[model samples]
Target: MVDFQEFCKHLPFGLLIVNYKGEIIYKSQICENLLNNSDPNIKHIQDILPDSSIIKVIKEGKFDISPYKLKEEMYLIQIALEPGKLGGILFIPEGVIQDIINASPRVLELKHELESIMNLSGELVTISDSNGIILRVNNACEQIVGVKEHDLIGKSVYEMEKSGVITSSSTKYVLEKKQKVTMKQTTKSGRRLMVDGYPIFNNDGSLNKVINISKDVTEISILKKRLEETKNLLDYYQKELYVFQKSEQEIVYQSKAMEKLYDLACRIADVDATIFLHGETGVGKEVLARTIHNLSNRKDAPFIKVNCGAIPESIMESELFGYSKGTFTGGHKEGKKGLALAAHKGTLFLDEIGELPLNLQAKLLQLLQEKQFTPLGSTSPVQVDVRFITATNRNLEEMVREGSFREDLYYRLYVIPIAVPSLAERKEDIPFLINYFAEKYSHKYNHYKTFHPEVIQLFVDHKWKGNVRELQNTVERLILTVPSSQIEMHHLPDKLINTKTKVRGNMNLKQAMEQFEKQILIQTLETSATMREASKKLGVDASTITRKVKKYGINIAKLQFLL
Candidate 1:
């Protein structure tokens, strides 16, 4: 792709055409590069360089020369606007003054065009000697500085410093660096001036003449300060948008219900509050809770997961609240920190918090309220800063009403409640889930079999009452039994693909097919107790049902006895 912006990058030495009224309507080849070292075509010169000398030359019809240096090279670039002609001149320093005379025809032509013109005027034109003495200045210099340039021509440029510009080591530094410096210099006239100190050097790189170009900046400086404040505000908003983008992409979803949940999760991840996850077994509740933790402010801190369902009710208390070395039988000899302590300075995800016995719920509630907990048999209380996120399939609200769960604990965990929808509601996502499970099991058992479209649809259409766990088990079974390169619809359990529609509202398309499939498989198996006879009854190859039975997670032991 051709980028015109690339061309704008080469415009340090530039020219322009302007009307008598001082508005610049056109700039030459190097104008864009001079402004930003980037795209040159962006309109509006004031926006590009708010304090522009382009306007000054056009208004006053001035012949202006500003000395500048870049990368060890000196330049005496001159700008001139002639009367009656709208065109301008850009006399660029060609390496050294002598180099311009011997350069290409294009350079020679431009030099001739600029030198032929005369009678240029501007606000101020200053010429200084090699020793930093003011050598000459035009009549406008008197009006601007409130002093006749002729009276100060022989004096050192440093002597006119009574108007708010106090020279520092910065002046010496610019000379030593041999670079252009922009600074404020007060003239003897008590006028505040915004100035640029330009250094001019000869072909031998010796100091020649240094010129100072200045403009009154009392108003412009105030606007610049305001602009800085707005930029700071934009930077903060940009950071917030970045966080939102990262969180949105991290939420992986294959189902609509989950998709909505993910969007909601991203919105509130940064908020300061406890969150609770509720879902059935094997639905990745803990994983979701951890995701919230990783997205929150405390991401760099620890993320501790304690599965209350997995621990014995008796020791659950001791495990959560640290125990003294000899507090109980079988306690750690050196005393162990509890799960709460281990989770300090980060998130503590209490999985299956509902299973925490009612007697212990009070203690958990107390810790949440005070943000502190005492280790079992340790009289001293331990204070810690921790964010608690709990997950449970059991309905804490229902248990509270039944008096089996603590009401106080229930409210504490339900601050930001999120319900992970059941798999049945996301049946539209069954196809994706099937593929994921199939791939996982195939890799686990070192067996590979691709599924036919019809076979996969059978899995998708089936009512997954057992949700993801049951679905995973079914995939593992199919991987073990199916021998063909592809699994077919008949390979699915007859109860799913062959079932009668008579199965009440409990039956989706999958359950109906499954019932019909099972009847055909059993009848065929009993007819000859042979795959050949079974495949014939089901109108498929004997190898197909062998795969179907495994994939459907059917108990073949019962079928064999009946056969």
Candidate 2:
């Protein structure tokens, strides 16, 4: 008979014996070879087969057979408790089932077909055992991760990470989670990768392998960054375009004072703070307020303008706070939403706010403080979401002192007080405004007209106490009523023509004389039909008058136009 050790080594299956303490007592030569262990003694069977069911078999004294996976191979294992002792024995077939399958011609063909499919993929594909050993990698792996198949295959992912071949591994996460995982990784080639890892399990519910599919997203990431930058640049240019268009259409100005004021308006446009516009009448305060509303986030909402001074005091409360149905005789049967409610989620411009009655000022103050107000005949307070932009020509501070305007209401409206300058203060913008309004009214009345130089000079010199409103009305009147295309000094209103040009600074005798002479020549040219008539009226030779006319740069054509 053969010796026991030799006979056990010659057996076709691998065997392991464990004592009741679950410590390995004996292992055959085939078992040692199958487990890839060369040691004479092993501490536990779990050291080789970590998922072994031998301990349960010993505890319950039961017998069971199951498939055990090791690395990339599968083996059928037989587990049974010892007949008379509190010990267990595990029988593992020496020939792996995967090896038997690999030997078949059909399985080999399918394996080659699968490998061809995997290598043909554009995305990097990798397979690693549960122990972190890389078993296979596709051809795309070299192009994406800059690693060769031979270099990564059979190598440990942890070692590759330590060696800096790849920055991180999704396989590590899959192993930890025992589920699918997706992560971003970088390689030594400086390529960004989006990797999705899937954990594959065996029939015994034990981790078998991790499959990682990776896509090179380096170009996509760069393109995304560039797209974001382009979008931001487009937004900036669009805003600049809006400001330019707005300046040309509305709030036309060129003076540094107006420029600075408009810049402040734009800066505070989007904020929800209450804006108080204070200026003289006809100073374009309403236009400026509308500009603010257009630039604000509520540009799409309603812009309700209520002239506090225009409405009568008796119905002012109902017009502002709205009234319920049948609140008063002859009232609308369905009731009105009122100016405040109509301007919901928008701007409410209360022009001449200082003219608001004392009692209504209290209600306005309540609305400003609490964002809610009661209708005239309603017991319940209706909420409102309105941005307040109030304008006044009167001094609210003086009114507050006189007990005419509410002190609390005045302070509430004074949160962001912006003083709009009168047109006379920004005289540099006068010529441009005149031209804009001239062209505007010319279009409105369907007549084209131009102002004579002398008429424009008179407009610039005259102190427009009525501000822009007076100037706009004058331009509209001239455009409508002036018979000729060229508007001269005689075409102006008597008030504008008779107005004396105020000498702004201290002038010497020569400068005063020259200015007086220029004015006389202009006036004489307006009345006189001919150059000879103007010279005779001045009691000067025609040549002297012509020399003074040239010196003063006076347009002799005005006399011709008048004729």
Q: Let me know the TM-score candidate 2 reaches against the reference structure.
A: 0.59
Per-residue accuracy of model 2 over 403-521 as CA lDDT, tens digit each: 88888788899999999999878775677688889888888788999987666666777888889999988899889999999998678777875673343255544565576568667
Task: Give stretches of model 1 more than 4 Å off.
Answer: 1-252, 494-563
Q: Who wins the lDDT comparison?
A: 2
Ten consecutive residues with minimal summed lDDT in candidate 1?
162-171
lDDT of each: 0.66, 0.82
